[model samples]
Target: MSHEQIQSCIEECLRCVQACNHCFDACLQEEHVAMMRECIRLDRECADLCAFAAQAMSLNSSYAKELCRLCADVCEACGNECKKHEHDHCQRCAEACFICAMACRAVAA
Candidate 1:
C-alpha cells in the first residue's frame, strides 16, 4: 500500500502502543495488582505488536498487511481484557485498542 494509504493505520498503531504502555504501568500500580495480571500481560503484548505493525507500515514492508491483521487480533484481545477493569487507564486503553483494531482491519482488508 502507498504511504498515504497506510498513514492512518500507522498513527492508530502508535496511539495504541502509547495507551497500552501507559495502561501496563498504571495497572502495576493498582491496589489489587493480582487482579490486573491478564490485563498487564495483554497490554505488553498489544503494545509490542502495535509498535511492530507501525514500524512495518512505516517501512513499507511486504508483510504489512499480515502484520496489521495480527495486530488487529491482539488489539481486540487486549481491549476486551482492559474493558474488564474499572480504572481510568484501563478504560482509556480499551478505547485506544478498539480504535486501533478498526484501523488495522481497514488497512488489512
Candidate 2:
C-alpha cells in the first residue's frame, strides 16, 4: 500500500484509541458502572489493539495487514458494545470505532 493509504489508516487508528480510552474512563464514572462492564472492557481492548495496529503500520511491518484485520474485529465489537449505552461518550466512541473499523478493513484489504 502507498504511504498515503497507510497514513489514513494510522490516523483512524489513533483517533479510535483516543475515543476508546475516553469512553473507558467515562464508563467507569457512570452511575451504574457495573452495567457498563462489557463496554469498558471492550473499550480497553479496542484501544490497545488500535494502538498496536497504528504502531505496526508506522513501522511498515509485514504483519501490518494482519494486525489491522484483528483491529477491525476488536473495533467492531467495541462499537457494538458502546452502541448499547445512552451516554454521549459512548455514542461518540461508537462512531469512532465504526470509522476505524472501516479504515482498518481498507488497509487490510
Candidate 3:
C-alpha cells in the first residue's frame, strides 16, 4: 500500500544517512584528506537530505515528494563521488546511496 511504500522509503533514507555519515568519517581519516574534499562535502549533503526526506515522510508532509526528489538527486551525486574512491566504506556508501535513490524515486512516483 502507499503507506508501506512511504515507510520503506523512509527506512532506505535512514540507511543512506548512516552510510553517508560512515563514509564521511572514513574519508576524513584517509591519508590524502585534501583529495577527499569533494567526497566529504557530497557525503554531508546527502546525509542531510536523506534525514530531511525521512522526517518529511514520517510526518506525511505535503512536501514529502519534493524532498524525496531532492534526496534522490543528492544520493545519486554522493554515490557517484563515493564510487570514485577505493575505500570499502566509500563502496558501501555508494551502494546505499544507489538503493536509497531508487526507493526515493518509488515514493516520488
Candidate 4:
C-alpha cells in the first residue's frame, strides 16, 4: 500500500478506537444500561481490533491485510450496534466506525 493510504488507515483506526471507548463509557452511564449490553461488548471488540490493526499496519506486518479485514468486520458490527441506540455518543461512534471500516477495507484491497 502507498504511504498515504497506510497513514490514513492508521489515523482512522486510532479515531475508531477513541470513539469506541467513549461510546462504551457513555453507554455505561445511560439509564437503560441493561439494553446497551451488546453495544458495550461490541465497543470493546471494535476498539481492540482497531488498535491491533493499526499496530500491524505501522510495523508493516505480513498479516496486516488479514488483520485489517477482521478490523473492518468488527467496525461494521460495532457501527450497526451503535446505530440501534439514540444516544449522541453512539451516533458519533457509529460514524467513526463506518469511516474506519471503509479506510481499512481500502487498505486491504
Candidate 5:
C-alpha cells in the first residue's frame, strides 16, 4: 500500500473504533438495552474489523481487500443499528460508521 493509503486506512480505522465504542456505550444506556444486544455485538465486531483492515493496509497484505469487505459490512450493520436510536452518541456513531464504510469501499474498489 502507498503511504497515503496507509494513512487513509489508519484514519478510517480510528474513526470506526471510536464509533463502535460509542455505540456500545450508547447501547448500554438504551431503555431497551436487551433489544440492543445485537447492535452492541456488531459494534464490537466492526471495531475489530476496522483495526484489522488498517493493519492489513499498513502491511500491504494481499488480504487487504477481503478485510476491507468485512469492514464495510460490519460498518453498515453498525450504522443500521445506531440509526434506530435517537441518542446523540448513537447519531454520531452512525455517521462515523457510514464514513468508515465509504472509506472501506474505496479501498476495496
Candidate 6:
C-alpha cells in the first residue's frame, strides 16, 4: 500500500479503538454491567488488535495483512458481543466494529 493508503487505514483503526473505548465506558454505566464483562473484554481485545494493525500498516510490515485479518476477526466478535445489548452505546459500538471489520477484511492479505 502507498503511504496515503496506509495512513488512512491507521486512521480508521484509531477511530475503531476510540469507539471501542467509548463503548466500554458506556457499558460500565449500565445497570447490567455485570453481564457485560465479556463484552467489555472483547471490546478491549479488538481495540488492541486494531492498534496493532495500525502499527503494522504504518511500518509497511510483512505481517500487516495477517494483523489486519486478525483485527477484522476480533472486531467482528466484538461487534457480535456488543449487539447482544440494547443500549445506545452498544449499538453504536457494534456499528463501528462492523465498519472496521469490513475495511480490514477488504484489505487483508
Model 2 C-alpha lDDT per residue in residues 28-104, reported as the tens digit of each score: 99999999999989999999999999999999899999999999999999999999899999999999999999999
Pitting candidate 4 against candidate 5, the one with the higher TM-score is 4
lDDT of all predictions, in order shown?
Answer: 0.96, 0.96, 0.94, 0.96, 0.83, 0.85
Alpha-carbon lDDT of model 5: 0.83
Q: Write the per-residue lDDT of candidate 5 for residues 8-109, one digit (tens) a residue.
A: 867977888987887787788889888888788888888888888888887879998888878898899889988887878778888888888888887777
lDDT of 4 by residue, 1-108 (tens): 799999999999999999999999999999999999999999999999999999999998999999998899999999999998999999999999999999999998
- Weakest 10 consecutive residues, lDDT, candidate 5? 1-10
Error of 5 at 60 (Å): 1.6
Note the clash tally of each candidate.
Answer: 0, 0, 0, 0, 0, 0
Model 2 lDDT at residue 95: 99
lDDT of 3 by residue, 1-109 (tens): 2988999999999999999999999999999999899999999999999999999999989999989988999999999999998899999999999999999999988
Per-candidate TM equals 0.96, 0.98, 0.97, 0.98, 0.87, 0.89
Model 3: weakest 10-residue lDDT segment is: 1-10
Candidate 1 whole-model C-alpha lDDT, 0 to 1:
0.96
The residue pairs found clashing in candidate 1 are none
* RMSD for each of the candidates: 1.0, 0.6, 0.9, 0.6, 1.7, 1.6
Candidate 3 lDDT at 27 equals 94
Tens digits of per-residue lDDT for model 1, 61-108: 989999999999999999999999999999999999999999999999
> Model 2, stretches more than 4 Å misplaced?
none
